[model samples]
Target: MDSLEQLNQRLREGVRCDGDYPPVPGEGNPNSPVVLIGHSPSGTDAQTGRPYSGPAGELLDELLAEAGVKREELYITNLVKCWTWREENGLRVNRTPSAKEIKEWVPAWLKPELELIRPKAIVCMGGPTAQHFLGKDFKITLQGGQWLELPEDSPYLKLTGHRLDPKPFVMGVVQPNYLTHLQEHAPETYPAARANLVADLLKIKRVLEGKLPKPKAPKQEELDIPF
Candidate 1:
């Protein structure tokens, strides 16, 4: 089995991938009870060589503290390991990763990382991260904050060879960057957005401590909202 250090080395080396920016591996304790998965790194991540190190990261830190969780105690990573971007008007603008990129990278890189960490609960921050583990039709706006259980036979686990000893709890939330955007452009919605994210983080703490019931699969009717 590859160790976390080995995985980080692979990511830093940019082995087996092609992208303008070098891969940014997840950071924090490998055995952390909770794992945070984001969409992808931003240009700031490329410069700082850290996941969630930009404005989004700053807000995330504040939210983590509000939830009484230390940044060092949780494993943090991204769905796409690198900073995806495009040159526009002489500036590098971050872009959402294409589905093809996610499809290719998850199995080869993210899956193995999950297998190694084997977190008891996964907090997927943003649409891509949620959809990758949940389902393509997952809409964070409608289902955010609802806990969903990942069973032993879940394709995610089966693909990563994760053990069923501790069934993982998964929850979705809006991306921190999106929340920041709201704070800037849609000021009216910022408070509600931040509150929802804080609530989700607190729920994660409760789930980790067994203070709450394991999340059940959502009913089909519950998930019928337009994406």
Candidate 2:
């Protein structure tokens, strides 16, 4: 089977949830620079078999648009291919999948999805997806907003960072959900997070276009929002 077909088969068998993956792998622009990774399919997303639905997705789409990356120009996926939820007092509440679960499912399908897309950079949306895509050692507080090498033995089952003709760099960022939270609860941190995200996207763009100068990460002050 071709890579996409193989990826779907793994998703069906590996992820222990009812959510369906996108009917087919999204046809991202071959020129896309970043792969946006999330943790799992939300309830609506699972039923629809699409990544990012409802308000969260709309916010993410807006963020991407602000960064000059169109939806069609980027690839998106989740650490777990299906939605994992539990019934709580008659309501289904989402829970973060366990580390063991992420380890089990991501390698089988998500990694293959990355291999097929072969994006220039991987932008993990939150700590969980970041950790899943990079390795157990991945840390958001320590490593967020910087480019780093994907660890050896990553679940990118068929995708090997060591084997890349030109290795792709991985980046971590605050998830849109957290961004929304910060906007509501701790407005102080919102500007910085948003700035960091845009800066990272610009850096990714420059690197992909061959204009970047050996990855000189900008300092926090340099990322100050232009007003």
Candidate 3:
């Protein structure tokens, strides 16, 4: 994991894939101080072999532009590198990885990525993702956009089995899909939520500018693993 080349080679050579879809290795600055981790790939991501695509990608691009951030300046990837789905009513639908699936994949896929990039901060794209590193009851409405640290036993760290010294700080933000949904189905609430999303996006810039203080790991109490 000394380089992105080694990481991607491991992903391509040693990693097992169901062969329905291959792992979507992260794209962007290999040494970025921030990484955006999603729960898993969407249908479009699987099809295009990219992390964000279609509506979600569009919204993310626009938000990055508005926040005065460039995509190439940040690393982006999903916790689960490949896509997961189930068939229902004669249709194929996207689904989150099961606890079992996550257990099987994360150490192999995500651990090394973090080890290589060593981002100083991460943005969890949605509640479930936020919960992965933060705890289950980490209320996004109350805590999003604030400086925080992952618990010592945070799933991302433990599952990856790699402890980054002075571990990367954490922040939570609304997923693009949620914002898109809000815009389409709940217009009344969309404006306020979208504004919050923009503010959260800007925090990345503040972090890079050395304006926000790095968070120390909060005291450990029993916290729910968001399986």
Candidate 4:
């Protein structure tokens, strides 16, 4: 797919992940410097064809604004195309997707998206996303704001339909949805999570600006040790 039209065509006619949702909005540039990857669009977002249109998105917009990043500056998307939700006790609750669903659909659409957008940094929003991209061994509490280098042969590249070349770095941050939970119950931790989001955003900014090189790998000594 050489253009957005082709990409959308492939997503619609070529691949069938979830048809309940609308086509992903925004012209996801393969050349964008940063990419913010999250879970599927929330109920509101799915309806509007915009990522993060709900409460969590509101928090994300606030946090990004604080970090001096505009919504248009970075490419944003989700690992899953449809919301995995069911009515529970008369209210709808989002649930983590089954492994089978991810395995089947991720490579078909989401992974190719990363290869196409080739962001300088990919901020995995929550544990599910981090687990998908970083691996099952990833512990969000310990490594949430820390940087991990992409594998030597990982597909962080700009694809000219077939050719792929290194394009950007990938990073992880606490998901805004997680913070929305904290904001409702654990108000104290909410600020810290938001701060971490801003700090991570700034770190990525510095790396992109050439002020800081790729972050060094975290050592055991730097692990989060909550006593």
Q: Which candidate comes out best when scored by TM-score?
A: 3
Error of 3 at 208 (Å): 2.6
Computed on alpha carbons, the lDDT of every model, listed in order, comes to 0.76, 0.64, 0.77, 0.62
TM-score of each: 0.86, 0.75, 0.88, 0.79
Tens-digit per-residue lDDT, 1-227, candidate 4: 45645665666555333436564443344566667787566767767767777788788788878887776677777766666567799876666666766665566666567666755566777767765665545566667777676543332222113232453444667777777677888998877777877887777566545553455553332333110
Writing each residue's lDDT as its tens digit, candidate 1 over 81-163 gives: 87888899998788878877777677888888877887788888876677767776667766778888764445455455656
Least lDDT summed over 10 consecutive residues: which range in candidate 1? Answer: 218-227
How far in Å is the alpha carbon of 103 misplaced in model 4?
Answer: 1.3
Off by over 4 Å in 4: 9-19, 23-30, 152-164, 207-212, 218-227
Residue pairs clashing, model 3: none
TM-score for model 1? Answer: 0.86
- Tell me model 3's lDDT, rounded to 2 decimals: 0.77
Q: How many residue pairs collide in each prediction?
A: 0, 0, 0, 5
Clashing pairs in 2: none
lDDT of 2 by residue, 1-227 (tens): 34665666655555445433342233355456667777776777766667787567787777777777677767777777667778999988667777776767665566566666666677787777666656656566666778877556655533433364346777777777777788898999999887777766665556556652343232222222111
Q: Which ten-residue region of model 4 has the weakest summed lDDT?
A: 155-164
Which lDDT tens digits does candidate 3 get at residues 142-167?
Answer: 67677687787677666776788548
Clashing pairs in 1: none
